[model samples]
Target: MSEVAIIGAGYYGFKPITDEVSFREGTFLAAMRAYEQCNIDPRKDVDSFIACEEDFNVGIAISNEFAVDQLGGVLKPVSTVTSESLIGLASGYMLIKSGLCDIVVVEAHSKASNLVSPEKILEFAMDPVYERFLNFHPNYLASLEARNYMEKRGISNDDLALIIKKNKENGLLNPRASYSITVDLEAVKKSEKIFDPLSEYDIAQYTDAFVVVVLASKEKAEKLSNKPVWIEGLYWCSESSLTPLRGFSTNALELAAQKVYDRTNLNPKYIDFFEIDDRFSYRELMHIEALKVSNKDTIKKDLREGRFSKEGDRIVNASGGYLATGVPLDAGGLARVYEAFLQLRNEAGQMQLKNANRCLIASWRGIPTSTYAVCALSNGA
Candidate 1:
């Protein structure tokens, strides 16, 4: 199979609400920026299109129908992935490697503000017979995991606060980080608790965003882009959706990371930085342990000592991650990838890490589902 490289990318609508633009318009704006960046005519150059979204997310039964023309994919081989964005990227890569397309456009967005009760929608993803009867949102599950993880890993509320403090401060440097604000550990520690150990601010907020990325085969990439970020490997994994069956102490994210590492022959130490799941503060620590970057025993010290910061030995969530940037639903993985792409190419302006050449990104489908996708990228052809 041919290697796939991201040649052009664009992002738009990283806000709490985008009242002026509809979802389709948001996607179109991102698409336009991507086209302009790579100097490609979408209609003529894009051989296929993939839009990552869910029916409930767009508030329309058949959301992909409305997304077709706005993406300049009319009469083209356009399809939708109800899963997260990484899957869409994988699908696009498959299309190109199968000799079906040279250039594939992949898009994902979040119109989270439009949902009347986003929690209710998330609730619907649960098994109605067993889980939905609780009538509480999935945050309860997160709180359960947080409490369980803390007990097993010996992590504390203060440690989680440090993670929040560092990431939020990092967000201050990110233009797209809507939730980025000045915060201190004491302030986070004192915040009101949403669910026991989990606080009201511990959860990552939602934002409106549409991110589009252009992928081309190696041959096309070399001809089209002077700075193409190649996808070294990508894979996603999931535990059973049954919340009762899941072990709160461990998650599928670690399994996903191992698979990607095995596929790419790379690990945490080799990558310059990471953009792992941080929708919940504890999840960041959990994922780190699962990824084998560091364990819970020493991660707190590593985090406090700035090992994961920009000036630290290894950089993590340099884009402020989902905590600061606002989780963009299915777009979450691509959002991280977009940031990695910018950093690898030295285009991430204020948030750019000096001389970062390779990056790893992992995304988790929010609660009630243990699905996670891991991808490794490099500037090398």
Candidate 2:
């Protein structure tokens, strides 16, 4: 496979909705910013474009049309992946690896403000036969997963609260984060309950935002930027859609993780930092176990010990993660990778970790459907 690297990255997003701008305007601003940062003329340099989008979120079936001109993909070979943001990223990687394209621009954005009934949109993701009939809130799936984690692995509510507190505190230093506040464990526990075990604070907030990144082959990257974050390995997987039938402790994330790890020949212990899809607070813990970074029983203990803090040895979600940071549907995964790219390049301002080298980024597409993507990035290949 041809080596791929992130030559430049740019993002423009704010908390809540921006009435001053339309969805296309907001996304265009972000794409332009990324192109400027790369210092590459998009019209002349980029060979193709991969846009990540979903129909319901944008109130339009073909959201890619909104981003084409702004991304300098006016008449290029642009493709849309509605599955997940990371899947779109995977498509970009494949395009470059095949030698069909050397420089590819990937963009994803979410103007959740356009959705009149976001919950109704989420319902469409449920299992048509069994789960959708229950009329359960989408969060009930997280609650069920959390409940199973507690019963099968002895995880505690206090553990989930601690994770929330830590991630929020981490967000305080991130200027781009939407919900960067300090909250105590008691405050988290007192928050309104959305599900039996999951509270409102335990879940990520919805926001309108955009994120974009530029990828290039090794030769192109070397000529464009002196500091390039190498894409060592990337993989994605999905498990059975029948969430009710599968064991709560079982997740397909491990399969994706193993695939990336094996391809990169990197060990979990070697990873210096990570940006995981913590759509729910408990997901951070569950993903830690699924990635085999730590045992299920030790997640809470490790979190309390500041093992995952920005200042800790193994920094996790220094950009506040999807939980503390707002979740912008399709753009969430790219945001995580953007943070990783900044950290690896020593460009992350306050949330930067010391001498960061290796980083892992993972994204999950919520419940019922178990879609996951894992990308391994490093300063060196």
Candidate 3:
């Protein structure tokens, strides 16, 4: 059996606005950087290409068509994943493991600034019969979850604030953190609530970003780079599209985590770090519990004790996560994967962890959906 390894990663335009480069230009640049890092010739060495983007997000019905030439996929097997980009990575992994392709490229991005009405677009994703009729801000969906999570788990506003404080402060070390800021729990607690207890600062700001990752078979990985981050396990899950059937307090992350952990035969104790979703401040705590790293009763304590802080026993979202880095829609998951890649390679610079060996990256497609994905990466062969 051939194991897939992530040999290279490239990123660009994680900004509030990127006036300089168009979406295709950013995609080309990121793809070029990945090819350069892995020493692969896209025109010849690549076997297939997977791009992750929503047609609605890109404002084009057939966005992948415009991407083919730019990504160097010209006549090669090029496809798209409408979900998060990690699904694209999973696609590449399967392609290699099945002995169909030796090297595969995965790309995803966000040009959120280009969206004339982001809310309307998201509203359109809601279930027509159920959620769309409510016609409330999509955050209302998250609010219901947030309130339920808080009451059941005994999570307080201050507990949620701690996450915002830690992540944004941690973002101080991240060059890509567009919304990074320094504030106390009081500030977060006092901020105007968009959906009671879920304050303005509790939500991750949307930004633009482009990420590209290259996955290759074991043979190609060893040949392409001296340090190859192996994909130990990968899984993605989607619960009910109907919000009524979804577990608001407990997200799909647990289901995804269960599969990955079972396949990898590794537990949270083996993970040196984590880069899970923090699109909503409360969701961070909720997800950690769902991932089984800790439970509702204990995670808030762990957080308050600084156990999950950058310098604490368990470091999570050291790149500040989406809370600090800003969410790039479907691209957000790949960004987490990219950050884990940097950490495993000891190339995270100021955000680098000492002797970091294994890590987990998880993501949730925000609001009115229960989509989640998880993948484990190890520096060891």
Candidate 4:
């Protein structure tokens, strides 16, 4: 099989506001760090570049056109992916596997602090004629889904509260998780409800951050770095954008995980851990279910037994996830990938996992879109 490994990864910010750096500068810092890790001179060694961004988020019709200069792609081939960042990572993998490039870079960033009315902009994602007129907040979508999924799976409010407490606390160990906090179940239970069945604490806020990853073919990867995180299995599938046509069954993650697991001949039990999109508290659970980390019959039981905790058999979101880091817009998925890269390389400080040789990472496009990205990474084992 064709082998591609992530040789380097870097980021600039993980904060609610990064007014200090423009997206271009943020991406530059991140890419420079990633390139440095692999001892790469991007202007010479990198073959192509992929930027995960959306026009709406950046307020430009073709924003990535402006991203090239900062990435050392002034005259090189560059592509833009409007999907989640992991999709761009997968695109880079395809480029390598297709014999089109020996080395590639993937990046995603969020400058959400510049957007004045993000809620209004987010509303535009709903079906223009069908759903937008409902005239309520978009997060209600997650609330409804969480309520439905919990009911079917016997998940309760306490489970949601535990998820909040666990992940936010996990954030304490991650320097990048500005949203990280030490909260108990009681504080979570008392949090204000923003949507039915979902409180403000249940959702991840937005942050301005950039994540860049350098991937190379097996030969170059080995030549460039002593520690490489190989892409064992990678795939991303989005459920239909038309919400009415879907069942909200974690279909996106299931489809993507099935493809990834099939590629690596691995299963949930075989994985060392996972770093999934906890854009919402229950989403972490929903994604865990979809990845088959635990069967529905016992997932709730597993939670009660602390099997998904930091020290549990199934370690998830070791970076505090989006719950602690806030959302990074298109960069959200890549952020999850960033966490996976850290654990596999033993760079995830206090949250580090012993012998973290393999992990699964997942991401969602966030409200109004059921699109998701799921990834599996190994320490080139």
Q: Candidate 3: count the clashes.
A: 0
Model 4 TM-score, all chains together: 0.97
Report, for every candidate in turn, its global Cα lDDT versus the true structure.
Answer: 0.88, 0.82, 0.88, 0.87
C-alpha-based local distance difference test score of model 3: 0.88
Q: After superposition, how far is residue 52 of candidate 2 from its true place, in Å?
A: 0.6
Clash count in backbone of candidate 4: 0
Task: Note the residue pairs that clash in candidate 3.
Answer: none
Q: Residue 217 in candidate 2 has what lDDT?
A: 90
**lDDT for each residue of candidate 4 in 98-145, tens digit (9 for 90 to 100):** 989999999899998989989888889989887888898888888888
True-structure RMSD, every candidate: 1.3, 1.6, 1.2, 1.2
Query: What TM-score would every model get versus the actual structure?
Result: 0.97, 0.96, 0.98, 0.97
